[model samples]
Target: MQSSSKKETIDCFENAIKNLNNVRTLYTENFVNWKGVTKDSKEYYTEIIAEELINKINNENIISENIKPLERENYKVPSRGKTFISNTNRKEENVAKRIDKMECGELGHILYYQMPLKPNNKIKKVGKIDLVSFKKDENIVYVIELKVANKNETLLRAILEIITYYQQLNQTNFINSFKDDLGDKYKKVEIQPAVLLTCDCRAYEEVEQLDERPYLKELIKKLDVELFSLSLNIQSIE
Candidate 1:
């Protein structure tokens, strides 16, 4: 790659990393200069924004980071889940705990929940991956972000989180942490990012399309991530 081209790709990645969390509108709004849009031009302008983001996300030049000196919670659920998990996330943790205890069934066995990533801020608040698992007979590790029914998060936002975390996981550290659990085949198992959605979640609803392909679905297909609509039988404590 030319020096200029490589630099451009890095810039694209850094920009997306900063704007990812703030993205809410799927088609119309974007990180690019888009505030001046008019109603008539909204549809046309949206396509431009979508196409631009599509190019950025679909670009194969983005760099993936491996945070050396990586860490995990082993396979055990952390006690901080009770206090570290805020009331808002306590509800989410309820689901995380249930998934941790129950058999993965078609989803596969849980390796761990709340996988940590490098924190960008100085205060050192790290983001946690919802769940990580492996299939019974497959050489693939699933890094999953879960959204339960009626979650208010936009589909695009959830997609970004999984993609970012998948890129940030250190392969050597993750597998070696459970070397005894995976055996020699651990070297061959690849990390696959996934979104596990409970039926009727906002993320689930947004991806449902027949007349035309949803941009989010197209992006997921282009990025090669997995999507699963799972049915969990846990009764809500809310």
Candidate 2:
């Protein structure tokens, strides 16, 4: 049987994940330009919701005791049709900071960084990765792909998607692609590509299966891509 502390921890984490999802949904739904707002004045409401989640996490004493209140210190009301790119950046930075603060063998230790995925054409299939990293010294960045389950198939898809990104944004090809727009400066920016996977799902158990894929192995051989499955277990204090 699960201990009361364990159960409370699971519940707290579940609630946190739900709130995170809500934040992402609101951000995606109202996303427009760089401001991250909706024309219908929904940005204020979304900000309010995010504030509430943060407050609940910060002020609550016990997992199932007093009700949690919403806090607004950490978030801002976005402008209509504006994108949540800034928030995403904040999230990634926070993830990195959290990893930096941890001891060895801590959960959620991996950090992710910016990974852009643009298709050959205009139609976009997946969103751009915000950030991913595996210890600054490890020299591995995960191109995070969040999902619930069935990681074997998901990891395969992630591998292909990252390869496409590699083919588009690498040193040799990008310089020419941006030559007309960037002129001489295009060659000046030195950018190394890193690919990885990030999710809150318990799929790390299947990590070995992912490393064995033929196409995945080939892609890794050429591009140095990596795979990381993230799982967060937050305990609620009483």
Candidate 3:
């Protein structure tokens, strides 16, 4: 006869499998009837929903209590849309945190990640700067926008975002608030905007060409923002 603990473990596995089968059936039926939906869109939604269901099942307390832990292994979740798998694997926020630890000689003195910027009398935050560094020696402030992917669309959007941050920081009241945050060391600081890319993909070359466009070229010159790229290396250890 099966032991009580063994039976419970078997039951947990059965329930999880049953739930997954139900999810699959529902997904198939829904997709078949989903009119005007593109194939890629359908697949994206189905994969996301399936992953959510798996997560829910995996988190059940009953399963945790009854089943023994499985051996550790790497799992790759399906990518959605045009996103690169590497970006999701490493995570943009994680990369940004790592970058925050680097010394800033000309970059800045104090580095802040996800700094909130709100205009006067506004309750809602207008925007959150990805990274802000200050150089007390030169009285210069750097607003850095970090992106995991170097896609053209992503770079363009980041450019606009950093520009907005620079404009807001230039406001008289906003500058006063910034000075207060930085203390007396940075009494007068000039704002410099920048976009940092983690990957050296094809978009890097495209961004260079984009800089030559008359309107974009003028905007970059006027904002005095710099575009920089950094690469990350990873090795496996046995």
Candidate 4:
């Protein structure tokens, strides 16, 4: 459904976020009834409503040119930090390290761990990406967002966040940072958006089920975002 006004568009996104907590369990059972309806009273399937909201938000989203790169010392592929910015997401750190270790022929040889994105001088920091993998041989760059097996975040939330992050990145500034710091190998990389889910997570399992849903397939086709599931060797991140 095309949003007739900007407020309607914002309403769609705000509504989805408000209902985000229910998506993992109640998505298939709910519907996005008209605006102002209580969350409990909405009456429609999630994919149908979410598909519209996602398309709306994604179509309107654009990469802000304000993103600036840090100094050469900060662009290190194998990050020095062992913990996330929050210092609590050990599982994410573990996954990033594991991906960083893989051969370039595999998931990507060079990885950027918890890379901080600076939106502008005023904000200083916008957000930190989970990981960015560069495969030199194929000249492909994967902008990845990682979620561990125990994470309970919903599939829709993953879709929304990865899309937002991928779009928010300043491609021109980011590419310049890579070329100036990492060398010519990154000059022609093909950037792709991705979401990495630990094999047993709710989002992973939920995504597998989404494969048969046309709305989801359509959504993926529209976004061009890839979904991957990794089976971690360790028993638990705990």
Q: Which model, 3 or 4, shows the larger lDDT? A: 4
lDDT of each: 0.57, 0.35, 0.48, 0.57
lDDT of 1: 0.57
Task: Give the candidates in order of TM-score, highest first.
Answer: 1, 4, 3, 2
lDDT of 1 by residue, 1-238 (tens): 1122333333543555565443322222232222223343333222233345577655632323222233442433346454232346355556776666355766688767776664333524346788878875887778898877655555655666677566656667777766765678788887788988887676676567412334545667765678877776535533
Pick the TM-score winner: 1
Q: What's the lDDT for residue 1 in model 4? A: 29
Better of 2 and 4 by TM-score: 4
Runs of candidate 2 with Cα error greater than 4 angstroms are: 1-126, 132-153, 170-206, 210-219, 234-238
Off by over 4 Å in 4: 1-45, 54-89, 104-106, 120-125, 180-182
By summed lDDT, the worst window of 10 consecutive residues in model 4 runs over 61-70
| Residue 79 miss distance in model 3 (angstroms) | 34
TM-score per candidate, in order? Answer: 0.68, 0.33, 0.49, 0.65
For candidate 3, lDDT tens digit of each residue in 13-97?
3454465423222212322121121233332222232233345445752222322222212111123233222334544555555
Candidate 2 lDDT over 1-238, as tens digits, reads 1123323333443454465423222223321111223334333222233334345535652212322122212111123242223333244334433443243231223332333433333633434544432333342223343333333333333433444344333344433433443344555543333333345332333345434333334434444445544444312100
lDDT of 4 by residue, 1-238 (tens): 2223434444554564554432222222223322222334332233555556556447643212221233333333443656433335577766676566465334565456677654434653245677887767677777777778654556655664566566666676667657743467766777888888878776786677775446656766676878877777644444
